[model samples]
Target: MGRTVDQEVHAAFVEFRAKEDDKVRCVVYFCLSVQCIYCQQIRAKNTSRQKQHLLECPGLRGHPNAPQPSQPAQAAPNGIGPPNGYPGTPNGPTATPSGPSGPGTIPAPNGTLMTNGVNPHATPLQAPLQALQNRAAMATPVQATGPPSAPPSAASRPTPKPKSKNSTSSLPAPPLDDVHAAFVEFRAKEEDKCLSVQCIYCQQVRAKNTSRQRQHLLECPTYLSVMKDSIPANNLLHTFPEGDVARSLQIPAPTLELDFRMSIKMNPKVNVGAGIWGQREWVSFIGGQWAGRWGKGIVLPGGQDTQLVTKDSATNLSASFMLQTVDDPPAFIVVRTDGWLTGAKDVLEKVIDSNMADGVNPGSYKYRVNLSMETGDERYTFLNTLMWIGSGCRRGHEVIFDSFRVN
Candidate 1:
């Protein structure tokens, strides 16, 4: 409805003005306005004070624009031109004031900022004050006894000088990109030898332990187990942040617990399995086993919450969590097994071809099912963020994941 005469819609605006977002924005706008006003006032005062002091200072005495006793105050002398008011002008400081002096300065007649009908910028300093002007024109307090005395300055002031092209301040020395480059070169020398591995480039450098290789047996099984696990692991998107580097420990092939790579290398056909709760659970995995387009990969059944319940149900398996960017190549895959399922590897291959170059769409690939399982101190705030792997050189790739019971 239209408002009646004298009735304004301002009330309607003011009434709804305090909504959460609106009130917050309003406060921000108000603070900004106040700050702008204060800044303008400060700038105005500084500019005005600078011009006034320049008008009466003597240290500026030798300056070409400095006022002289012999010269009658020149006409509206703007800063710099031909003579007195101007740099090389004829009727500059040498010229007599067409009018007598009493006022400090006249305003700039052509510009805005007129006060008392005077163009302040147009005003020239009166030469009569030359006697009173010191290197600094000290506006002093009058002592009842002595002649008008020069007063101490409220603050110390520095004399200004002409700048030259040769002045160090003229051109900032070029940014020290050279110094930065040198730093990079120096750091390169301190890098680990392994970082120079062939066929790969990294934005980071790692440091190697100079000490002779210690017994790697303990971690031997761990490494193979991890790689074996990840070979067919599924990934979760929007679960980890962008640019995050992940690390996981793979359990060795079950039979030869403690070490699988060594076992595999020793025996090309070493059966791998899981051992937990005094039971043995073997895993069957292979790639490119069947005819054309047939699935070829490992199998990992979606973990059951029951795995954490009784010792009998638990499988001595270790899995690491990693994030795969939506639409990116499959970084991992996990096959599900139901009591030695038939054609286990086929499922893995099916999930692979479906996901390869097409990971964004759902059900396109077989994934180790996650029922929105959140365990550790999940970074809930950044759940939807893109995730990437960290530099092994920068962050140690030994991240550990602990299982928590979910109700």
Candidate 2:
């Protein structure tokens, strides 16, 4: 038939003992079993008492048979226990035993009428035991299962702190000693103002803030590439909007034109020197007068014109002079004239032979001059922004240049 109650109970104890270490052993004494480690003091021969002792024993901490706080000996919240408990223990109330012991009956921990490992007569004690078991289960930490969770998203993380204004200032100052030594660099005399720097690359003299100066050093293609590393990248450099540079650099077309008659008093040419290129002649400008739609102006004296007569059938001449207007508030204009005289015959020889001033001329020569003028006069500041194309024609003791603004 089926196994006896003693055999089943003993089998359960043997199974438990097999899973434990030698530190906590189950010992049999006649009809009872006890824990060897704790049996010396209590001297209990009951298997149920031995199980209770094993639960509380300090030596059984790491043993498999040791009780876990999560899985207590008492029934669960809905009156559920281990599979070895009596019938109806998982379903509802404890099942009543037909006799003192039956096939489906389990022994109680205390010395009382047992039914499915629970005491049928001990109704008052069940509440306290369940409370203890509930507390133990609640105190235990539940383990996670499945794949590990992903890290928090960038948006969820705490925002980074804003960098101080001086953080990027740590980079070494622009290397003024090396390649940029030719550039004019000076700090602003006033506090909190930008430095005045004359960039040799663009040949522009302008005052730029520290941040813009650093950005220029980084963005300028003419600057030495190796020197760019001296400045650290910062938000200020990138704050400028895209295409803003292109828009800022968009130049407008010229709109106005002027033709002026100029009288020139030139000095005798002096041979300066000769080089592999050609001969060089120094021509000094004594004085002149110019009158046009703009106004009447006097070409001040003390200007010099350098002529480079090359062997390649070409002549390049450059003249630097000043022009003073006869306006109510006199304004001074700095003029730089560069010209190219091409063909075999020299430009001065053509002027004399053709008798251009007397209205006797042949269209067999070509001489063109470009004029760059800079003036501080507010009324004529527009001359600084527009490009002018000028062509010179000799007329007697005077020269007439038709200046057309390239529209």
Candidate 3:
């Protein structure tokens, strides 16, 4: 029942030591929260930078150049309570006590009570060590909600809030303040480097132009910004095909190709062994109006001459021919008329999207032929008919020509 003076002193020292430890742990948690918030602000600024540069950022919304995020603003440095009228920040800002710094926790000059900042989840034995250590620490509790096991870096920033599935997945874009700042920086330098682009309209001779102007023109009437899946404006280079007068036309059509090689194999064979033709006089195609347009051609004679062989009466009168792709596609498609006996002249000009094409003129092409709507009921042999059939013609009247108007 008796205790020595040395034992008594040791017991008292241990009690004092425990009180100080609790304070230290509290300080650590408080500092960590401050750091996390600081990091978030930094990241928000960085996102704004990327968006303004037109760098592929999926998060920036509203505009590509916004500054800080519209979420909660920064907390006070000394962990003071929030100011009145902060619309979205959490409340309980003025509560100086992090966790029940209540009765008899060491008194301090500022009559405010500080909490014991203990993570209640600490093991039972660890709690005593924490309580003793925290006596000197005045750490604040962060109202953070998430996996505590994760490190501060992961835990700091709020996760991208789940978006409505039905809504478009694109973000609203980064804040505009930062975005414009970045955009201004880019614009200042982008103009220094310009490239030459052919004018689709006026068909001016090629010359160097500013890429800056072009980039800025993403909002231009002629300049269309493709969101997704649409044809890229750059894919097409527009210029007048050939003409003395410059036209105010702009045809920015993509390259056109006839996929005969692939389509021929996939489709069923055409049955050509059984058709018949009516007899008529075959004539040379003379240039004249056909299908309401002037066609380029020479008139011979034509009226459906029934024959399988090519002859003056056949080839001369009817100028129907097969096509072969010796060059790039969009061969001009047009329409025209033959002069005499409706002159066995053929027409091709039909598909000239006037809106898209500038300075288009009066001509069409099939086998590079310059006629439209061949008349006189005479037909000429298809020269490279094999390209379409994938084999020799089975019979004279069986194989038919597939025609396309070139641009």
Of 1 and 3, the candidate ranking higher by lDDT: 3
Per-residue accuracy of model 1 over 99-155 as CA lDDT, tens digit each: 243333322323333333333333233232222222113344322121132212213
Which candidate do you rate higher for lDDT, 2 or 3?
2
Global lDDT of model 1: 0.23
Tell me the whole-model lDDT of each prediction, alpha carbons only.
0.23, 0.50, 0.26
Candidate 1 error regions (>4 Å)? 1-82, 86-125, 128-407
Q: Against the hidden reference, what TM-scores do the models get?
A: 0.17, 0.34, 0.19
Error of 2 at 382 (Å): 1.4
User: For candidate 1, what is the TM-score?
Assistant: 0.17
Q: Would you list the clashing residue pairs of candidate 2?
A: 86-116, 357-396
Q: Say which candidate scores most in TM-score.
A: 2
Best by lDDT: 2
Q: What is the lDDT of residue 346 in candidate 2?
A: 54
Off by over 4 Å in 3: 1-82, 85-93, 96-367, 370-402, 405-407
For each of the candidates, give the backbone clash count: 44, 2, 76
